[model samples]
Target: MAAAVFLVVVVVGIVSAVVAMSHRSPVVNVLSLVVTLFCVAASYALLGAEFLAAAQILIYAGAILVLFLFVVMLLNAPEEQRPKEPRPFQRAVGLLLALLAGVGGVAVLIGIEVVAPAARVSGDARAIGRLLVGPYIFAFEFISVVLLAALVGALVLVKRKH
Candidate 1:
């Protein structure tokens, strides 16, 4: 049952990601990205990482996706500006590269030995908090700084446009 739910979420996330990347309208792309994020959160939940699932929804789906949509709306970029198709040569090259990468990834996965699951610490919010503050402190601080910079940059850009 959990595996079935995970599979569905994975499929949805893939479709949403493709739609987000291929869409011409910024608004629609942002909406698709939000859907992708939500599906990923659901996948995390199905994997028993409830804390990560909640954080994924709260941070990416709720905050970042909303910010992206707000920026897209504020910019009011015309749909016509988006490229509908790549050059033929670019498309060919991209396809060839994708095929090569996929082949290599499959080979690597097939070569890996299966391992039994190790005993895991309970993944409660408290455990997550401890890990974040201890081992991932630098990453946490770095992300906060990056977000702050992005906010300042957005404000500056909007101010200049007005």
Candidate 2:
């Protein structure tokens, strides 16, 4: 079932993201993050959001992950340094958050009911393109320009001397 597959992919994505954070090696972390991203795309596709799936893969998995890897390599980062034990307060906060998240997840899972959506031209590229180019053209263009500016700003910040 699509619902089951979506649930599995979501679980996998969350696990991979956690694993990515735990990994000491930058390359392994990046790969784990890519796996998480791919899982996200898979879940999107399962939900019939093809455009979102493609955007997830192409933007996060392709561009952003590659950029992270490049930055890692350029910096020649060593294995991540970590304290053997977290501070007591930090550990308590982490535990509290984890417990709250687990409880919330269980509540959501219990509350979920599968229902089919009404038939529609979901993820139709033509329809999306028409909307983007028609009523929302200016907003779309503005967002693109803002994203481009942010990218340039990040590059400038990274290259700047302290």
Candidate 3:
């Protein structure tokens, strides 16, 4: 049952990612991305990473996706922008870069051996707080700053046009 649920979440995540990438409308794409984030959070929950799941839902699905949708609506972006075909050279370069990334990821995965799951931690909130403040302190602060900048930029852009 757990395995089936995990599989379903993974499949949904993949489908949502594909939809997000392939959708022509920005609003639809953002909605698809939110769906993807939700699936990711579900996966995290299944893996017993409750704190991570909540963070994924709160930060990515709630805050970031909402901001994306708001910006798209505020700009009144067109539903169907003309797609640009990449030049041959650009396409070749992109393919090469993608291949390199794929190879690197495969190599890393092969090098790292999977470990069995440890006992699940209780007090998820406290654990997450400690984790964020310890090794991930810089990342937490960086994200906060980035979010602040995005908010300020959005306000400035909207205000100037008004």
Candidate 4:
């Protein structure tokens, strides 16, 4: 039953993500992304990582989706104004990339089944904390600095616009 549910969640996530990517309307895309994120959170819950699941719902579905909506509103993007005909060259390239992605996804699924127990132990917060404070400490600090810069840059942009 768990396996069946997991399969269903995976399918929903994939379908929603594809919708999010392929939609022309910014609002539709953002809502679709939120659905995809919700599916991911549900999958995490089914997999016994309640903390991760909650974080996914709270941080991604709540905060990130709100951020995406804010960006869409701030941009004041126009509605879909697509060309009447799709380019064959671009279609061919897109198909090729999609095929490659499918193959890569399958490989990843198989690899997950064979991953060492130690790698699978990342479901716990302490393990994640250790990773952040250990080998990934530099990356953690770097991202904080980057985020700070981004916030300052956004403030500067707003000030200039006023």
Q: lDDT of each structure?
A: 0.87, 0.89, 0.89, 0.88
lDDT by residue for model 1 over 1-162, one digit each (tens)? 877887888899999999999988889999998999899888777667889889999989888889888888888888957457799999999999999999999999999998997766566799888988999999988999998998999778769543
Cα error, candidate 1, residue 50 (Å): 1.3
lDDT for each residue of candidate 3 in 1-162, tens digit (9 for 90 to 100): 998998898899899899999988999999999989999889888877888889899999888899899889999988786679889999999999999999999999999989997787663788889988999999999999998998899778769552
TM agreement with the true structure for every prediction? 0.79, 0.77, 0.75, 0.70
Over the stretch 9-127, how does candidate 2's per-residue lDDT look in tens digits? Answer: 98999999999999889999999999999998897777777888898999998899999999899999999778588899999999999999999999999999978977855885777
Query: lDDT score of model 3?
Result: 0.89
Q: Which has the better TM-score: candidate 1, or candidate 2?
A: 1
TM-score order of candidates, best first?
1, 2, 3, 4
The RMSD (Cα, Å) of candidate 4 is: 3.8
Minimum summed lDDT over a 10-residue window in model 2 is located at 118-127
- lDDT accuracy of residue 86 in candidate 1: 90
Rate residue 128 of model 1 by lDDT: 88
* Candidate 4 displacement at residue 157 in angstroms: 3.1
| Displacement of the residue 61 alpha carbon in candidate 4, Å | 1.5
Q: Which pairs in model 2 have colliding backbones?
A: none
Specify the highest-TM-score model's number: 1
